[model samples]
Target: MPAEWEPHEGTWLSWPRREGISFPGRYDAVPALWRAMVTTLATGEHVYVNVGDEAQEAEVRAVLFGHEAVARTALDASAATSLATTVRGDRVSLHDRVSLHRIPTDEPWCRDHGPTFLVRDGELTLIDWRYNAWGGKYPPYDRDDAVPSRIAELLGVRAFHPGIVLEGGAIDVNGRGTVLTTESCLLNPNRNPSLGRAEIEAYLREYLNAPHVVWLGAGIAGDDTDGHVDDLTRFVAPRTVVTAVEADPADVNYGPLRENLHRLRAAHDQDGRSLEVVELPMPGAVEWEGQRLPASYANFYVGNEAVLVPTFAHDNDAVALDVLRRCFPGRRAVGIDATALVWGLGAFHCATQQQPLAVHT
Candidate 1:
């Protein structure tokens, strides 16, 4: 398997359509978030967006055109700026390193459905894990399930089918030998009820080439997909993890999050070293129609030169940005107002996938 820390050739994103789960009457906001994220990523690396047709691609071009920001202004601006000029025609050019693809996909959460590329012994390979629309939360997911294979075909690479249901959001790799995940998401009866925790861990080790599997108990309240680890914790570096925490014991996530913290503290890495844990505050509960949304700051996506964090326009946005800035010293931490975006129950990381540069022998 390729090292998870390898530099990405570009990131993949699927344009949000009007008709999809979590996207009823909120298509504009969702695409706007996608535009912002793609623009921000263009500043640092390449971005490949999957558009359904020419019409959608034209609309996307117009949106990106309106967001172009000069390099100097971007540095001084505290608020997010769009790099509109970089996107033209069907291609959004960013310093010759960035490229955009108009591939067709049914849903927008490509990170969960896209191919997990790995490099082994100077050879590039792909891990095509089965994606069942978050444990069949949505059906007829034939399109989403085929995305990884399509990407692998485009890259002319070999893809290995793990045959088990898994989403990229459920696992975090340390680029060495450790992978972190939550039992609530992986072992949930909805996903793979037949497989035990140990069995699932065995699968991860065999496919991801992981030597150690650290399990967290559950996810926070209001997460629809049982407990995706991306929304609760992330590996900032090998042996270092940033996890969400609720200071108030009365908060709904207090117990579950604290339990995960305890496990992480007791867990050891491949080297048997205790994990370095950083606590990030969860965005205040955001409820829509009596339903709480999964609003978490730990769902931030790491780009080539920046980290795109989902901000809820809450009082904690600045604090979350600062925490991420500390975790990624040299990389800029830009916040995308995800208040409107989360209505669909996903954020930046959930919507984007990274393609590592092809390794050479």
Candidate 2:
């Protein structure tokens, strides 16, 4: 698996459906966030969106291509900047950069169900990890599970079936040989009861080309996927990671996050070098109707020219952005208001999957 900061041919997004179970009530308000992502991502690389049908494709087009009108009405101030000025105040052409595929999905969490791309020996391949809808927390994921094969067919790339339950969001790689994941998510019997830790690690080694695996303890509170590492920690460099930390000792996330940080510091990369850990502040707590949503700055998606970060309306929004900017010094770190997006239980990283650029020999 290529690192997210690596060049990308495009980013994959499984367009959300109005009737989908992700956003129960805030479906209407979700398109604005999609527009923000499409426009900002289009500025750096092509965006391949998976739509169920023509109508869904057309709706996505309106929100992305009609930036002039939508920017004035639908987009707020921050999103307006994404649509109008991205690099050097230049307007991005979403019409040229965004392409809609007819591939359908059961839900919008592409990071979990979308294709995981691998570039090795100048060849790009796709991995079709069995998706049981996060341990069957959500059912009828047939469409989502088929996304990798469909995308492989579309891209004319070879698809490899790992024959195990693994979400793309369950692991993070440094484009080297090191992988980051949580034992809570990967070891849960709900996911792959038949496979043990060593067996799962072997799968990661064979498929992702990651020989070293760093296992974290657990995820934050209200994380429905047991404990996905993407919300808890992320690889910023080959030997460096930025983990989410909760300062309040009384908070439910404090202990778990602190433990993960300690593990990262003692962890080693593929070269047996000690890892450098950076602390990324959590956006306090974002709740909707007494339900705490999984909102973490670690969910930022790295683009070719920008990093789309999930920012709750908190004072730490600036702090997170600054931290990400420093981590990805060459890219613009743009924080989109995820107050409404996280109500669906995920943010940008959860909604996107990066397709790394392949260079043929």
lDDT of 2 by residue, 137-199 (tens): 888999998999999999999989988999988999999999999999999999999989999
TM-score of each: 0.91, 0.96
Clashing pairs in 1: 1-119, 2-118, 2-119, 46-98, 67-82, 67-84, 68-83, 68-84
Which regions in candidate 1 have their CA more than 4 angstroms from the true location? 1-6, 66-92, 95-98
Relative to the unseen true structure, what is the C-alpha lDDT of residue 352 in candidate 1, on a scale of 0 to 100? 82
Residue 24: error of model 1 in Å?
0.4
**Model-by-model lDDT, in order?**
0.79, 0.88
- Top-TM-score structure, candidate number: 2
Model 1 over residues 161-265: C-alpha lDDT tens digits? Answer: 978889988888888888999988999887888999889989988998897999998887788778999998888888889999988888899999999989988
| Local lDDT at 325 for model 2 | 93
Best by lDDT: 2
Look at candidate 2 and tell me the lDDT of residue 242: 95
Cα displacement (angstroms), candidate 2, residue 265, comes to: 1.3
